[model samples]
Structures are given as structure tokens and as C-alpha cells.
Target: MTAAVESEAPAEVLPGLYDIDAELYHSDPIPGGSLSSSGARKLATECPAKFKYWSEHPQPVKKEFELGTAAHTLILGDGPELVVVDAEKWTTNAVKAEVAAIRAEGKTPLKPSDLKRVTEMVAALRADPDAAPFLEPGSGVAEQSAFWEDHGIWRRARFDWLRHDGQLVDYKTTKSANPSDLPKVIHDWGYHQQQEYYLDAGLALDLVDPEKPFQFVLQEKEPPYLVVVTTCDPVARGIGRHLNDRALNTFALCRASGEWPGYLEAPLTALPAWVERQYA
Candidate 1:
């Protein structure tokens, strides 16, 4: 007899609130290749408003690295109980070493320079009266600033961790000015679609307790900059809900209309050509 495999239930997510459907239909991203704010600024002195937003907000990008670390530890594993994806063997070994060190002492698993950057950022934030609440160890809201819920999408999101009480977070890294000021950073990065998507997916999955408030972890840095923590207010959460709902609805519309390929193709088409040009 064949053994039966139990499939996991799909995670729930919140709806998007922005005009994403319209936006997607009206405007499509250049499609492929990673571009940083500096690239955008270099592309144009004025740059697109979108790129400008990114330059003003660097935390989201740093959060990507933090998520990568979490994915390495929590999701990808080996020795018969795990599957490795997206990362190479060397990267896996490095993660294993780092995880081991975390178990050995109070020292951070991330690099010393990274830790120093984070500590300095925290100090800077604490220095600012407005940023203090979010940086304080016991700041109830700060501790549980952000939470994640699983979405049964193609790739799992890294924002799965929550405080014991279910606070979601998206940690950031930057080498910027005093880390004390958080509100401004939060405002710049918090409005992006990806942030809303994370929040929405979590909300839908019911991964986060509705009773707890939601927030993001903003890390800002310049070349010589370090980490600083920032948070969003109710308005930010509301914006997340709106944007996520729109993305979801757009996805649904694409699926039903059988026009999904266009969206997928948009990136596929541009990326290969850009890569080929690099070689040529």
C-alpha cells in the first residue's frame, strides 16, 4: 500500500487596499535585474519617484538579508528532515556555523561589524526622544513591532518570526546617521508594495494574533552608517492593508482573466536581454 502524505493547509493573508489592479494594468516595472537606489539616482538626477522612495528608504533592502538568514536557519535544513533551496552548499555551511555560534554565547550570530552597527544604531535611536520607545528593551510595542504569517506562495517569506506574544518584525541594516530617528525611516519604507504584501500574507494566514498591533523594523545606514530602529503608526498599518488587498485582488484578476503570463513575462523578457548585454 502507498503511504499517504498529509499536505499542509494554506496560510491566510489580508486583502490589499491600494489601486494595485489599476496600477499593474497601467504601469509595469522594468521587469528584471536588481537595481538599488543609487542606481536609480544615477539613472536620473530626478529619478523615478519610485527609485527616489527607495533611496530615501534603505531598510527594506537590508531586511532582505535578515530574511535570508532566517530562511537558512528555520526553513532550509538537511540530514533527512530538511530541503535546501535558493542557497548554495557553502552558504548552508556558513549558516550552520553561525547558528552554532549563537548557541554558544550571548554574542550575535551576525558579524561583529554588523553587531557594532546595530548597537550604534540602537544608541542613536535611544538618544532621540521620539525614537526611544521603539528602541527600549521593554517597549511593549517595540518588542512586538512586527509579525509574520505564512503564505503558501512559491517562495516562503522570511518574516515568519514573532514575539512570544505575536509581534511581527522586519529587521533592517544601514550605515547612516544617528539611529535614534525612526519615524522618518518608517514612513519612507513602510509604504512599499512588498511591505504590504508581507503584512497582508501574515494577516490572511492568521499567523499573527489580531489582538497585537503590527509594525516594521526599519534599519538605516550609509557607508559609515549603522543600524537604527523605526516603526509605523496605525496609518502605516492601514496603508499596508490597502496595498496588500490590491496586490491580492490583482493576482486574482490575472489568474481568472488568463492574463497572468503577461505579468510573469514582463520580468522574464527583460532580465535575459539585460544579462546577455552584460556579456556582449
Candidate 2:
């Protein structure tokens, strides 16, 4: 709905160019939404048909997404003013009506059980030694949007939390916060690309201190609700940088040539890496 918002960047704290709230920014149409790192990664990983479907469709907000949103609000956001559910519990003749009411109000639709889990996550995070810095007053910036033209293409980032000291934190609510499980988790979600992309976006926007760290504040949804703050190392960041380069180049070529490819034209079977071990 709004064009690229250009403003004088903030001094040493974070870039302040696009000061709009999360709701309005997320509602932006077409190219404004198209060029986010998540979208780029999605396009890069998916078949052209899947990517095109997403480009044309409105995503169904799933229960997990609602829980994640609610958890973010409880832990790192403006909190429950934006969260609307019928009540702590309800048996009603009007399920659709209540949901429509929540949607109409421009709020996050969360269930009572969702809030309970979010509260649990907050407690877990608070108890974690790694969370002390983020818990400090004025330590972090929340939900700030920044947009700019990269080369000839427009791109954007909505930071979860950017510390004044220059560290960036992305809050994630997942089923597993176990250290051993994180690589696959991160790979599946393209979090390496996200961290690399977000950090670069922050640097380009002057929204963060480049020499500082980029981290994820990961908390599991299921008990015992483990939480940790961790960063991808140089190798992961390098891989991410390469992936982003290819994705961006692919996007630019697709834009110019108007070709959206799907599966490889050649026939091939896709197999898991572990399949080779089984052959052994």
C-alpha cells in the first residue's frame, strides 16, 4: 500500500527509514513483499510452480505460525494488544464469526493454549543465562522495517531484534532447541541465509554494527522449554552468501527473461544423503 519509505537513517542505533508498524509493512503489495530474503530463499529452493503459487496466493496462517507470532509478541514484541482470541476457553455457536471478528480487528488470532505456551516460553527464556542481555532495558529494537534498492531491485528486512551494541537477534519458537538438531533445523528453514541476509541488510541500511554478532534466540515450544542464543560460524555465513548470490542472480534473470522454471528438464531421482550409506 505504501511505496518504498526513504528517510534519514538513524545514528548508531538502527536505521529508521521505514518506521511503519509491522501490520502495515506486512500488508504491502507485490514487489514490496516480493523481494524479502525469505521470499528470495523460497524461490531459490522451490520449483518454479511452487514459487509462482506463493507469489499469487495468500498464505494460510497455520496454528504453528500463530503460536510463533504470539510467542514473539510475548517475548520480544509489543505484546497482547495485537493478540485477539475469543477468550481463554469457549464453546460457541459462532466459530467462523469470532475468527472473522479477530481478522477484521487487525490482530493476531491466538488460542488460549497458545498464550499459555508463550508464557511458558517467556519464563524459560528469562531463566536462561543467555537471555540476560536481551532482557535488559533499551537493549533491543523490535519489529523495525527497512527497505532499499539493491542494484536495480528493491529489497527489505523486518528485524526481530537489533541490539544497540550491534548484535542482531532472531527469535524462533521450535519443537527442538537441542544443539545437535539445530543444523538440520537451520538448513530446512534457510536460517543461515536469513542470518547472512539480515545482517547484510542491516549493514546496507546502517541498521546494525557490522563488526558485531548476529544471533538466533532459539526456544523450544515443548517442555522443558530449552532456550539458547547462537550464531552461525564463518563457513555457514559463506555458504549463505553464495546461496543468496545465486538466488538473486536467478531472480534477476527470471525477471528479465520472463521464464519461471520448475523441475530439471532431465529425469532424475532425488534421494536423501543417508541413502548412499544404505547402499554401503
Candidate 3:
């Protein structure tokens, strides 16, 4: 996989799409600085100070993500290689050492059981009548990175699967993919914001139509692996756009003033509405 070139100047990254490695994209190759959808969420929902710290300090890989990451690699035909550890448990020193070696080679390490689960998940996704069309081979590209300038600020997005017909698909593996639970999942995970942010990138790059909606292909990470194809409604999209604007403005201000402030020293406190109702 080819990595994106980084330079001291942000201008070096011309406004366009590039097929780059995931690691390079996550590393933020735009020299001066670039804001990603995840970073935008942090800036808008959390505090700027927290976002800054996260950007500076990349977190170590978590074991919980191994299954999902492996699923993506198998389903999308992109991302890191999935190396099976062939061990039932990771309790032994040899197994631990082997897992570390796999990671050192920039590949994901998974147990035999996890590998089987990931394979089954991919099979289920491909067999889905609705989800199959979006990810049909040669119909789209996966893990394509998009970089563009928004109001003089560098912004970037990595699309999971972008179809030639201007359809954007984001895949997510979750514990529960039931339709009834998606609204809360969308809000809790900031999927609305992510949808709009990715749409902005596609629009800026002329890869997506204004009328086309951003879609999510969510699947359960268990037997049967139920799949659902959904999109943000107009109202949710509006909220997403509003939040993205707030994040952009905050990011620009922080970049200009070099001040990433946290919350107020003494913020007003409020009890939960449910908690207060309990007293009634």
C-alpha cells in the first residue's frame, strides 16, 4: 500500500481524492494540520483541549477493534491484512509473542474463532439482497481518502465505499443492528455528523450528487449477522450540517489563536430530568 506524502506545507496536498493507506490517512498528512470527521466530532461534542491531545497522541490499538477491523478487511478487500493466530486462547507466552509479531508487521492478529466469525459476517453481508448491490465488486472503491479545503481550512474524509454512481456507503459492525435501536446508536456515535462530514467531502470533490443521501450498512457481529441499510433523514442531516459548521468554526478559531480551551472552571450543574422526576 502506498502512503501519502507529508510535507511541511499543507498546500502540497492538492484538493482531490487519493488512494492512500489507512495508516497514512489517519496520521493526518496535511502538513500544517487537517481536521477529520472524528476530530470534528471531538471538537464539537467534547472539548478542544481533548481533541488536541488526541490528535497529538494516537491511542494504541485496542483488542476489541480486532474483530471489526478484520471484518472490514475481508468485506471491503482493503485495510490491514488479517493474520490468524491459530490459538484457542492468548494465555501462553508463545501466543502473546506471535500476536505481537503480527502487529509489528502492520497486520491485525485474530484468533481462529474470530477469523471464522469475521468470515461468516462477510458472507452474510454479501448475501444480503439490499447491501450486496452497494458493494458489488468493481462497482465502487473502498477506503478512498478525500481531502479538500472548506473556508480555507483543510478537511479530510476516508470513505468506506464510494460507488461510481455517487453513492456513499459506510459500514459498521455492531452488537445490535435492529432498526429500533439505530436512532439512539446514531446519536450516541455521532453518525449524523459523520454522514454530513463525509458528504461535504464528496461534494467538494464532485464525487457525490447533492440529491444522493449518505448511507450506512450496519450489521450485527453475531450469528446470522443481520444487516440494515439506512440513511440520515433531512432533519438529521440538517443537525449534522449545523454541528459540522460549529466544529469547523471552533477548529478555525483554535488554529488561529493557538488556544484549545477546556470546559469552564466552574460550570453550572444540572440534574438529569429523570432523576429530578424521581423526587416528584
Scored by TM-score, the top model is 3
After aligning candidate 1 to the native by TM-score, how far in Å is the CA of 262 from where it should be? 7.3
Q: For candidate 1, which ten residues in a row score worst on lDDT?
A: 74-83
Instruction: Give lDDT tens digits, candidate 1, residues 203-261.
Output: 65454555654444444543333334334556765665564444444433443564433
| Ranking, lDDT, top scorer first | 3, 2, 1
Best by lDDT: 3
lDDT of 3 by residue, 1-280 (tens): 1223232224466887888787888899897889999998888898889989999998867889888899888888998998888898999999999999998888999988998899999999999999988888787788888889988999999999888788898999888889999999898899999999999998887888667677899999989999999998889889989999999999999999999999768667879999999998
TM values, all candidates: 0.38, 0.82, 0.93
Clash pairs (backbone) in predicted model 3: none
What lDDT does each candidate get?
0.37, 0.71, 0.87
Q: Where in model 1 is the C-alpha error above 4 Å?
A: 1-156, 175-196, 222-229, 260-280
lDDT of 3 at 180: 94
Q: All candidates: CA RMSD in angstroms?
A: 14.8, 5.1, 3.3
Candidate 2 residue-wise lDDT at 228: 76
TM-score of 3: 0.93
